[model samples]
Target: MLLMGVERFPTTADPHGEPAPGHTDWPRLPFVPGLMSRLDLAYKRVGYEVLSVAEPDRRAVMLHSDAAVHSSTTRIVHALSHGTPAADLSRSPAAAGQEHVHMVPACATLGTGTDVSQWVRIAHQQAQPTLFVIDLCRAGRSARLSELTRVPDGELNAWVIAATSPDRPAYDGRFSEAVAEVLEQIADHGLDTSPSIRFVRWDRVTRAIQNSLEGLGSSQRIHTTRVDVSQELPELPFFPNPRWRPGTRLEKLHDVVPPVRAFVADLGAEHFMDRVDDHFVGRQSQLHWLAAWLDDDRVGGLRVVTGAPGSGKSALLGALVCSGHEAVIDAAPDIRAYLSAQSPEGVCSPNPLLAAIHSRGRDIDAVMTSIALQWRLPSEPERRWSVADLISEAGTLPAVPALVFDALDEAEDPDDLMKSLLIPLAGAVRPDGRSLVRLLVGTRRWPAGPLLTLAGRDGGLLDLDDVPVEEIRSDLRSHMLRRLSSLPQYIPPEQRPIRTALAETVAEALTEETDRMHEWGPFLVARIFGHVLATQPVPDNVDAAVARGRTVPRSLPDVLELDLDRRPDGKDLRAVLAAVAFAKGDGFPTEAVAAVAPEFAPTPNVAAGCSLARATDQDLLQHVRGLLDAGSFYLRTGVETDGSTLYRLFHQGLADYLQAHPYPLDSATRSEAI
Candidate 1:
């Protein structure tokens, strides 16, 4: 790592009485030292050897008093670009045997002194993987740096993250500060591991920096440029997470579990798990059955859990993984006992008891790769492993490995997944005449074919539709009470009792509504009532709150419609929702929402209405944040592949709702619509 910065410029040099004509006497950046310190600390924490150009010898060469003999910036750029060994400017001596060099230069844009072209020149000479974190004004214009450094048809050696766009000036020291902050966060908290590896990539770092700057309300938009040489550079393991211990089974499992799965599990826990006491409530019978299936070696095969769209299938699967095998088995007594117990802490299972995967938007290769990783089997370079290979490998292990697949219907090719993977794995057996692996699956529906027939023959189908209505209602009530008890701290103490009573009234009203509408399950009823109670104005007394609760729409769609109608910025919020609804994969960043929001203009003449078409990017971002904060129940937030926050509908039902009621204006005709 090469860290360099110029806080201030000297007034005079030997031949040039003044510095270059365009160079400003740049103000002293007080935060430079702190930035360098933070970066050094973070890099060292993740086991990187750091070398700073601020060291005595390099500092003299960087800011030499005699510019007439040799320009300080010229020498610095030459040393960086060519690594002159004779002049003692080579970084290779310090970074000997290192495959990658990370260069962080925080300095002013002093004409040729800190011109991006000078930095781009480094990419041309360095053949090894190089990352340049350029924190300078108009750094976004340095997009060509990656292009200049590109190795055609090979692994990209150069990666660049610029502080701001070409048209905008970076705030003094703010970009560096944001970078330092993101580094510290990644070091301390650690990011979700990639599907194959546990390293932080350049894209992840760039997104983290962007999110950090946005969170701090800085106008600087971070830009990143990189080329994947043979798809290697994109997946290149740039930094080892401080938390990861190389070659550990636990770490391997963590690597295999997709970030989307973790995000969904978290989202499910928030809605279904007891928040007040941090306990998992309800689903005792199902939990007991699952526990028995896992414990019983004789009954080894595939077990399927089927339910309606909003019937808590994902929540149940999430509970299984989050609770772990032992916890779920122990918590099977009843809801009361479950509520009293401590919630499961970490998701990493020591033993290969449960290896789960979520199939949402994932292809067969990804699914197979995850399975291979979890099983600790030798991975092929081409990721050409088959279900037969997985089954064959499972026979080698002493203990029967349980594999869990959730949301199979959402896979890229559901039929292929079923026919090729799940069905074959379901019937797989060992030479000793025992099942090689235990399979657990959760889905809304299954194709009526061999797989379904096998499940039926084995009596492995656990239809949540069979779960009694009263039991579901009981769970819903418990969830509601827990959610209500954990009210925002901002609520006044004097109004606490009233709010508590109001929550109870709302819960009871929602339960009654569910009873009236038998089709509405725990997820649907809870989500609707939760949104209603969260968004509605808090009443002074229980009576008014109860009346408000009674006024909630009976049907889920009607409830969503009413909520949208109630918002003054309904159109803008709808636009955000549409973006989220249509987003592919896990979710999309706020930037994507802002980019597409303009097409959904507000209807004219609506009182106090504002159209997103006229909103600036910053304003759109703020509006999205406001919506997230206010209607958290309606939308879910997840971490994208690039380590940025992503927004999506809370449930598939919401997506269905949005699809049913499409935004009328087409993008081509949007201008006239506005």
Candidate 2:
């Protein structure tokens, strides 16, 4: 891309035009050529395709410079744009539009020893580049009074007027010195990963840097702002909504059709589709309470909305977003405008969450930016403001809307999150001396104390137990009905009622002795239903089954016992069955089996103790044929106790039944078992 600079005059000695080599004082330029060269080189070095253009309208053409090329300009541009020092220069512009062309004459007066505003005017006029106005007066101390470490200065600028004055050393003297020092530091150290710079005083842009650097660097990001540190900033209302509506620019964009669909596809409609809840029923009363909390014309703070697991917290949050709150919907446009003003990039940051905040609009972006900045994610540039800084700076932002953070537990660190985020945000007073924000957080039980404290301190805590049971019931019934109705020849739409009844019956039966069935949530209810159907006889046994279903044993042994009692073969197979039962879980641990009923250990045929030997004589083998065919037991390999292995009851109920009811022994020696 071509990196073109639109200027009234040309610095290059054009091959096709007159060279003004002798017309200017080159020595007094303060290495002006070097500065410009540095910017060009640095931008190119960072992989930005660079090109120089005196007249952009003309196809970018190269001209050999009559004067020596200085690297200062390239380095300065690179530092300002990417927070990186100059490295290398690209031979040519890589592509066209990707080039970040810096407009010249930004501080021509500074280097030429002249006025400052002239450069600002020139820089401001250039539409293609981001404006950078430097003041050489900020070379040493800053306007604001603050302690700072020494650093080199990188940027060069002219001063039309004194940035500092005697009446306020805070604004002028020390401030300018501080600013200059910071620039010098940037020049010397290059850009470190940590953008930890902060500004304590607005007018002391120079000095504030000194004050802020006393802190440590952040591992995440850096935040900077246009907020005045010395004076209190006016609280700005949150920005208006950014949602596209009729006759709006977004509407026009959407009207184009293809792109709008593409945009929706990009937003991952499918991802949230299953999780989205449209009408989260049973929370109407709670909704009203939340609305009232938001309307407090008094001090603005935050509210904690909590519930048990599966209490539909996510659903409710979705519903709130759709329904539009007094603070959010009404003021969306204003918030959008504010965000647009702050970040023209439209929030497409590399960070997914940050990107979401950016694209949605400014009010959200501002809040997210503040959070990210506090984490040292570089809200603006090289450094981030602290929590105190954010609270102070929030004044400049648009309406601080009622912020909502759902699924608090899902955050990386809930404890740190509560203390750092919720605490300050909850206590944040408005610019007008009232609370600026009304924050809302949704989390499950096992409540964090900090969260509770926040709730106790001026904010209301509304338990979600009151969430309607009907909603859960509705969700379950709908799911079951949909599944049943899908059968072609079976379970017609009319039969959906029967399915629902069956589901409800099963649910009630399982949870009747427990708690409210709906309170168990859909997942747990489904598990209970699965147990009922797995062992219950289907279709033919429907009626007797419904009544006896509750009687259904809760484990495998119970099922086996019931099956054995109803069948004739089980009686004849008494000895084998008894022996199998005795050797229950994990093959009944051979030694323990010998102690309990040891006659079986010596021989398969047992006449003593539990009547195993006698039962074996009565065609027990004949009776056991069915069970053997059914894969219940296999022959004992190796020793009767050692390698013993066979099918045992799989469920707890079966093992419990067999263990609880021990067969009576007939002989004393046999009864003693081994």
Cα RMSD for candidates in order: 10.9, 26.5
Alpha-carbon lDDT of model 2: 0.35
Candidates' TM-scores? 0.62, 0.32
Task: Count steric clashes of candidate 2.
Answer: 83
Candidate 1 structure quality by residue, lDDT tens digits, 390-460: 78887776677787788788778888988888888888888788887788887766452555567878888
Model 2 TM-score, 2 decimals: 0.32
lDDT scores in order: 0.57, 0.35
Tens-digit per-residue lDDT, 447-565, candidate 2: 46678666866647765654455544544444334333433422455444455565555434433432433233332233324333433334333454355435533223333444544
Best model number under TM-score: 1
Q: Return the lDDT, model 2, position 179.
A: 32
For residue 267, give model 1's deviation from the true position in Å.
Answer: 4.3
Question: Candidate 2, which segments miss by more than 4 Å at Cα?
Answer: 1-282, 291-299, 322-379, 382-385, 398-400, 456-459, 466-491, 506-674
